[model samples]
Target: MGIIDAHHHVWDLSVRDQDWITGPQLAPLRRDFPLSDLEPQARAASVDRTILVQTITVPEETPELLALAAESDLVAGVVGWIDLTASDVAEKLGRLRALPGGEWLRGIRHQVQGEPDPWWLTRPEVLRGLRTVADAELVYEVVALPHQLPAAVSAARHLPELTFVLDHLGKPPIVSGQLKPWSAAVRELASQPNTVCKLSGMVTEADWHEWTVDALRPYADTVLDAFGPQRLMFGSDWPVCTLAAGYAEVVDATGVLLAGLSPDEQAAVWTDTAERVYGADRPNQCRIRRVSPRGDASLD
Candidate 1:
């Protein structure tokens, strides 16, 4: 079956500075990373489809991403950004859906990790916005820190109709190797039937220069035990992961981490789960390359 990269990002520097790339450490991503730059790598990895996630919170970016999805062969779905707190959020979502190529708008995300308040997601207004998102049948991507996971769990509990995808496995503290609080909180969020977690961005969370598959295994296993393969999906996190490992290397490491699972479970992480979560069954624009059970290394 063809693999699906459930999450990744693209940004054009000329359009607007990704201001978050301010620090010297993020210098590698200062240059423009257009979809053209990612296509070859994605194709090389046998990734037939990808869900393009939002990078910045600006309103214009979503439409631009939707348009890009309409043009690109690789991107099958888009998790764009929206002002979730807006009073007319439902109407705004309708307007977005009416935009060119807007049908690919499968989900919405915000940079909740940067929010100073851990309870921001559980706030009254945000919950209202999430209700609108659910009514429109769009998923809400939870880009939150470990401390903010409780609010995510509460929000999910409040609005069970809205599917919540926890980005970066709630960003466990791999570099520090501390897992307890994060693991427990993550399990709480996973306990919600409407929630899912991405097995992405772990490499960057570990020591950028010196991370091993062994170093990430415990955190990965934590989520595997908590959410199971069906509720977990694969994501490359692409350019962000480039800060630590290359796309193929990330895929390879994931393969090693999941080697203990049966072929069917491995398939869920690599293909089936993403397809099911992101609704990627729509007619795809990209040329697909199938991978047999023995050919999994091609993704690595």
Candidate 2:
């Protein structure tokens, strides 16, 4: 079976500075990370397709990603940034779909993690924007911090028609080993039938240099129990995960975390869930290729 990385990102420093990539800790990510750098790594890991997600909230970035997706075979879908509070948000969505390679625009994402107000997702304008996204037959990805999960839950409950994808398990407190509030909030969000969670970004949340699969198990297990494999998908979180682990390491760790599941259940996390959630229709001609034990590409 083919695997789909549900979340990853790329950026060109020459085009625009990733303003968020500041300080000594994030220095490694300051350089450009184009799709060229990721394709090989993804192929090496047997990842047939990926969902390119937005790193920064810029209006122009979405179109650029769509164009890239149009040109690439690996990128199956894109979750882009859009100003949820914009008065003409619905019009914006329509215009975005009308752009070149717009069919790859599977979902919308905002940096809700950076918003100061914990209740930002509940704002009237934001809710209206989310409904517009739903009306457009798109999913809404929630990139929220743990404290903001209550609002995410509220938004999911309010818009049953919209599929709210919770990124990074709402970024649980892995380093601190705390689970209470984070786990509780995640369970609550998962209770909403429309809500789904990505098993990504945990490596960066832990002690980067010393993290082990056991350290990540709790957070992974929580979401698995809450959302089930059918509602949960795997994400590399790519260049960002490099802060703590390499792409292959992240993929291997996820496999270890999912070792207890049946093959069908594991298949859901590996590929099926992402395809279903993002509506990424794989064409008959676009067969997935797997790297052989001898390091040659072979049809899956």
TM-score for model 1?
Answer: 0.93
Cα lDDT for residue 115, candidate 1 = 97
Q: TM-score for each prediction?
A: 0.93, 0.93
Candidate 2: worst 10 consecutive residues by lDDT?
284-293
Model 2 lDDT per residue over 51-151, tens place: 99998888999999999988999999988889988888888987887888687888899999989999999999999999888777778899889999999
List per-candidate RMSD values in Å: 5.9, 6.9
Candidate 1 per-residue lDDT over residues 94-185, each given as its tens digit: 88888876888888899999999999998899999998887777788999999999999999889977778899999999999999899999
Task: Give Cα-based local distance difference scores for all models.
Answer: 0.85, 0.87
lDDT of 2 at 198: 94
